[model samples]
Target: MTDAQDLDIPTEPLPASVLTGFLGSGKTTLLRHLLSHPEMDETAVVINEFGEIGLDHHLVAEATEDMVLMNAGCLCCTIRGDLVETLRSLYRRRITREIPPFRRLVIETTGLADPAPILQTLMSDPLLVERFRLDGVITTVDAANGEVTLDAQIESVKQAAMADRLLLTKCDLVDQDRIDALTQRLAQLNPAAPILQVENGKTEPSSLFGCGLYDPASKSLDVQRWLKAEAYEHDEGHGHEHHHDVNRHDERVRSFCVTYDVPLDWDRLNAWVDMLITLYGQQILRIKGILCIAGEEKPLVIHAVQHVFHPPVELPSWPDDDHRSRIVFIVRDLPESLFQETIRSFNEE
Candidate 1:
């Protein structure tokens, strides 16, 4: 919440939300409520249903045929063919103007699905990485059963840890003391996410969204918060903040900005972007920067949503005389070594 005078507001497109949770976490109920919002009418939904019956579709009444259902149920396991192929087809439809030009796409992953692999598909796939932007991740927790679920189910813990927003549903069923204790435990698990209450699938959409790459209203981007938890309001657990587990995607995403003193060789910069976006772009959730090269007074801006990066934009004038290229990256399961190695390799050339 910087003051207007100090803020460097952004002007970019908003990414869609990725809602996930364990079974009975009320993810479908939340989606049903979200889709009911007048603002969500233009949103296309992709639901991953796990069971043979696949009754989740019947639960969502707002979406038309716009809802695409994946039969395998888990995104990580199904995406190699089913997930990737389906998303690719959807991309063509959107770009070719075949569909209603959905402003947002909500991918509702199955309760048991792991998010990292799904994120990987979105980032690695050439057809998708650039075409669709991952807005944010929202995870719902059963207020009454969360502690037990977290204790017994490691996947639920992972889901909660990675979420940008944590919704505690069934609040009416739990007492105040129990809710307070649950919040305390959740703080230890993942304090970076803001906790919101939901009863009967009713809550404000605004509180649940805009936790992604760019802030729609301000247009200003905060890479730290988007990839990691810098944008969150609280940090209660020192252990969770420094959790060093290196699994495919354990909510320990980290982000930082790099500055260059000299104006970059446009060709070199482009090459770096190409190599990184191609090699590990899927690992990189978001990348953006303002380039200040030697010859140009105005900055060259680069932005990427998932792996689909938009073309660079040359600003009308220099925002300031810093004359340093500044780029920020939101990377998941990415070590600082990757950035170091990339920089060293780029400079040796």
Candidate 2:
């Protein structure tokens, strides 16, 4: 009974972390300082307002309204029916445990939300893509008008080109010649996240959760940095990027793939990758994939950002076996026809 009891490994605990930014960029003052620390005991917030999930989080006495508003807080504005009914009511209260078995799930989008169609409605939700696993996207940049709010906002430069950690908040109202030219314009706009600064909204939950999801061998949350954001690099050119006419923030955020040989149904292939990044997530900036649904043996990865998505990830095997479901997107003037109409509308659903 020792090779780790032969081989089971899934104790049950890894799912939360979404939090985005743009409007005043502080994200509820860093969720009131991470619900007063102690590693956010039993954390489970949802707060997405503009239509529903918002109530000042009951004056944040450590949050809970099961909030998930969607009348405008841009989670791809009315995308595939309010992101599949807020992920089927947060995965049916997390599988009949009926709430509170939670150890994580802090959603919080809304400042014109677009965390890639709410991380592809939590990675192509068929039912929260095999329990739940995508813990990356933590944006929030401001550092006193974050470099002219990334040049008068393009959804604050697509929330800093779909971040994985950019924090930066106020920084004592800027002045080290404006926080060194806003940290050299965020290292020329995201050179693979890791830019923390914060001052008023405070920082440190281990510099906001270990990226790569969170897995120092099981501290959890590392789906290869929310599905390997092509190991990162977007250089800079976003004037609200276009695509085909070219402008993945001024070029080369390229990552292309669109396989098939069949096996889809996973929520109409995430509603055509959330209506093709809600009509070009500002130019299909960075998308990721690895799906192979149908009967499900292993392989179901999907990540997005022009329409804000990041949730589907299911792999218990076959990092190789050529199962076939790969999706990789990254855009700029739509061409691969919404990635071939998002896997041919999952064969007409």
Give the top-scoring candidate (lDDT).
Answer: 1
Per the 3 Å backbone cut-off, how many clashing residue pairs does candidate 1 have? Answer: 7
Error of 2 at 133 (Å): 17
Enumerate residue pairs that collide in model 1.
10-219, 10-220, 129-307, 129-308, 130-308, 263-293, 263-294
Residue 45 lDDT in model 1? 84
Q: Which tens-of-lDDT digit does each residue in 1-349 have in candidate 1?
A: 3344543222334266778888899998888988889988778888888866567878887346568887654776854468778776765565555666676778888888766567656655666655665666788999989877876676677677657788999989989998997787665455456788899888888787777544445545443343332332235653225433344233445555556666678877778778887888666765657777657766776767455666676666554445567776656567755765676567555
RMSD of candidate 2 to the truth, in angstroms, is 17.2
Residue lDDT tens for model 2, 27-85: 88888788788877666676766664555565456445444444444565654466666
Candidate 1 Cα misplacement greater than 4 A, ranges: 1-14, 215-218, 222-349
Listed per candidate, the RMSD to the true structure in angstroms reads: 9.2, 17.2
Score residue 88 of candidate 2 by CA lDDT: 62
